[model samples]
Target: MADVFRSLNLLETLKESIEHNKLSDVKDAVEDLLISRINLAVIGDRGDEKATFINSLRGLSAGDDGAAPSQSPVAPEEMASYPDPKHSDFRLWDLPPAPSTSPFEPEGYMDRVKFARYNAVFMTFSQPPQPNTVEVFLEARSQQRQTVYFILFAAAKGTEKTLEETRKASLEVLTSQGVALPKVYLVRPSTLEKFDFPGLLEDMGRELPEIRAHALLLALPTLTSTLITQKKEAFQALVWAAASLSGGVSAIPVPFVASMVDCSVALRIISKAQLSLCLDDESVERLARQRGMEPTGLKALRTCALSVEVTKGEVKKRLAAAEKDLGTVSPKLVEMAMPRHARSASRSFTAMLQALGGAIEEMAADGGKIVAAALGEGK
Candidate 1:
């Protein structure tokens, strides 16, 4: 109910801005939504595993351009930053390992790493909880950073019993060290589909701030159906913002001019959504390579025109098709939630909403199919 109210409030606000000719304000809001950043800090020993995990999170392999180095050269006291090649605003900072001293000093370490700047912290380890690790978690808690995670990598390849024992022992150690109810995720860095990695992303989506969570979801590769659905939801919100912006711009006196402007806005929005959902050519090829398949085969699975490329001709065709189905393509939930006055005020909003909403649905479907094909699920 609260979410519904928030959406309604946002719609009302946008409507008011459009009516009052505050298009600049609407434009700024849309821009901010599209370009939000998420800084994730990975605090672990610098090694191939840690570097591989960081690259995997960014949908890359070690040898991919802009991937984190397989062996970091930064000293133990410094931090190494790797930006997501697709989304520069989403960064991963590989911090130095926790101090190994018996008496753990968290303040100096935290300050040196600029811990507060990170939206989330992932502490990766293969062994039981060490004192320095516990101290870092405790300090993060004290600093009111609630999005910290304990990731146990390279521990999931063992038998189920061994994995359970590792988890139990880690939890017990953390409890003994006064860290209450610590969240630990056991993941195989090489294969996120194997274990707790999906759960970790779900937790982060719930815990991080709304904008950051959206950014994280869009920035990540479409690995699971759940992630594809989540990406759809995020892009739905983005489409709403973009539609509102289109409506605002349609306030221009010349109808043809307003239509042209809306088409450009729609093209930009759809292109960004394509990249976010990993429907672009490069992302598809990378995912194909990760799955050891030919890129052309994976690319063939995407049936939507906009899913593979966002050419001007494709956008026009999609828009024309959406126009014919406007009555059905306009999201029914959005229409029900919106007040009648707002709906009646702008035909352009409905048009853009239908066009972009349909494009997003098709692209999301394509993303799911690509993942399914890459994972060899339907075979």
Candidate 2:
């Protein structure tokens, strides 16, 4: 929301000032000092997978005459085959948490992502992808300049306990990286017509006033700008899911994003508003127990009220990003970075003004020389 404001350039303000010849030197300096800002896309890849679907919670039975609860390494295609449940996924890449026996490796065989740009990071386990862990990658993207990420073979569903683990894990990464975080927003839709998209966005902005602070760092402006900005257009397919989570509209303090310690305003906002992940429990869990352990009491990671919705291409890109996410950026780090940017803007523009003065001097010298030569010669 605030992206438009942060991107606002002082140079534009100086354009009027340039009309006066007295400040032409200043204008030259401003022009010279202008830094071309680029929209860099950093994508991380997580692996992809195939999962069995069944209507019975009775464990293929959710019990003993039940199908084995554990997946077998040697299980044949026939053993794993089950009726295609009406299973739909959440925003493109919401995977179930997959655990790993082997360390995170990039051998490339099972990895689904192929083409990548930006700083690509990978995250995965031997098991298939899960929803909660995927949030970590999403969180990482928020802290970066412009990021889009993924997860392969993830296994964490939108359970409470999984959310706790995800938050802890993300905090550790942010503590290490030391970068300002961006708004991590999830674009899910609501089933209750009362949850009108525009009203929801307005309410969300009210809940997190910080969103009005800076431009959200995103992979493609089109995805967030046109779609995410509009409730109906953005939440079209996503409305299938009950709820979604993302960072606050703006970056919060480090302590809030980190330990969730000391119980501050930022922490309160994060605990209440930011969603670590979202998905359709009806399609995936059905009769399975919905609740899980989560530390954030206010933000009880609920079983989504809506169905999951996403495009195939988005799924592919998200999965690819998951494979690459090795670190996370946190709000705590962003607060710490505030001091750096404070001096950056003022100093940069001042330097440009000085440079403009020098340019003016050179121009004046050249003009004087030309006039003198004209007089000395037969001009």
Candidate 3:
């Protein structure tokens, strides 16, 4: 119910912006939505664990280009950064190990790593929380950094009972050290879709800012059905924004071809959705490699046309087809919300909304198929 209201409120806001000729603001909002940066800091003692975790987070193998070097030792006193090859705006920073001294100063360590810059922080450890790491978590909490997470990398395959026991022990250690309500996520870096990684992402999505959460959802690999659903919601919000922008742009008396501009906007949105949903050839190949399956098998599961190659011609065709189905595809709420004078502009808005909405749904379905095939779920 809250989500529905929120979406309606956003639509109302965008409608007013378009009616008031605030096109520049709408453009800026769209640009920010598409290109915002999200910095994630991973703090851990073991270099290899941190590197492997970072690579998995970025949907890259250790040997893949731009992947964090598994063999490279993390600097003891400095931070190292690994940018997501697909989305440069999303960066993962590897922070140095916590101070081992008896009287650890978390403030100094935070300052050294420029902790305030990160959107979220992940503290990786194998065993129970160390005193130094607990101090850092306490300091982060004191500073109101609510997105900090404790990650336990269980390298060995363990039973669910053993993993649950480890998590409880870690939380007990944190509470023993005066940290309140500590939550530890036990995960195997090689299989992030398992264990508590999905829960960790859900918590992060709830804690981070709305736009940053959307960026995180779109930037992450679609490893599970839950993630694909989340990505679909995010892209739906994006489609609303793009549709509103198209309507606003059409109202302007620009010299350039309006259809060309609309096609360009639709192309960019669909192409981005394609890659984010892991429907692209490269993303599919990487997922297949990670799961030790043939890429051809996973590719065969994609039933959407836009799931493979998103070309301008296809986008234009979708837009034109949507124009003809405007009466059916157009949302009644959007039409009712528009001012009587702007009914003409609603045509472009409705068409673009329907076109992009369809594309997103198809791609999301394809993403689900690929995930199932890769995981051997249907078999």
Candidate 4:
């Protein structure tokens, strides 16, 4: 068979090459190994987004005959107009707000190939808003263009004497691990309703849309949304804001801080086993049985960017320095806002990390960045 013959030939070649000290054969074998290693190194160097961006660069973005030429992009209004001029994968464009009533016209100074990175529109809160108003396209688009976005939505409660209880409750929910975090935007929804991508684009300030984010945490009620009154609008705004961040844009993960979780379960759907924590005595047992989790001494965690109506418990204790660092804590001593469980989680971590156990996320983020920087130096 072909396989048997190949195996015999390989063995003979290996023996003869080794016995005769054939340096050329050794060189060829090493070259093969080196090529494989380089391929792996290249893959490792390219992270998820970068790899995808490379494919898009090859005009392989569209299906079938959809690939655009790496040289010239199609329309001046195309998102590809802002490709990295140097073949880098990043870009940002700014354009003016298009007319609310009419279609958004593309500016003339754009690269016909890449649209997304071509125009950086500057938005003004004027009566008759105009796209391409002040300045239009900045420069030539190439492979090196790039951009990203970040939004912070702190839904923490504040210290208002009359609304002390309201503040505490909101804090509890925000800090609760099970609660969902919502996105926030100061978007002009009137433009959104009219299918005005350009106007919506205008609202986001026409920079190349890349990574969009929303961070929800403890904040004054009005600054966030009052649970009773503006809750609905706040929730809707969050969804719209995230949806608009598209095309190579990665939506930032929402960190649901229980301005008070006595403060964070992550997510997907709550399993039946997890849902029982919301019910009463008999109902708790019943739900537990239905969900395939143990019913005895059961407790549930209702967490999300939004609320999942449940009975909330109160804990009063001065939050340690870690919890206090969350930006919403009262410097004027809070009565009793303790997460005793946070201590257990902290037990396994460093002192500073443990103290901030109440904020699993901030600790991970800020801590990781610092650690990476420290480690990077040695490298």
- Identify the leading candidate in terms of lDDT: 3
For each candidate in the order shown, give its overall lDDT on alpha carbons.
0.78, 0.25, 0.81, 0.24
What is candidate 4's lDDT per residue for 171-199, written digit by digit as tens?
Answer: 34333523234111222211111122223
* lDDT at 98, model 2: 26
Tens digit per residue, CA lDDT, model 1, 1-379: 2242353235556656666667667776666667788999998877878988998888998778988887787776789999988887799999988989876689988888899999999998877868898898998898888999999886535887888788888888988999877777988887887689999998987888867887788888787887888788777777777776665556545356456556787787788889888988899989888889999988887888889889888877766776566566435544543344445534666667777877898999999988888777878
lDDT for 378 (candidate 2): 43
User: Candidate 1, 272: how far from true, in Å?
Assistant: 1.6
- Give each model a TM-score: 0.90, 0.21, 0.93, 0.19
| Alpha carbon deviation, residue 18, candidate 1 (Å) | 4.5
Candidate 2: residue 268 Cα off by (Å) = 44
lDDT of 3 by residue, 175-226 (tens): 9999877788888887899888999998987889877887888898887898
Candidate 1: deviation at residue 228, Å?
A: 0.9
Off by over 4 Å in 2: 1-7, 10-46, 49-158, 169-379
Q: Model 2 Cα RMSD, Å?
A: 26.7
**Residue-by-residue lDDT tens digits, candidate 2, 45-89:** 222222211112111222323232334333231122222122111
- What does the lDDT come to for candidate 1? 0.78
Can you tell me which runs of candidate 3 are displaced by over 4 Å? 1-12, 252-261, 336-340
Question: Which should have the higher lDDT, number 1 or number 2?
Answer: 1
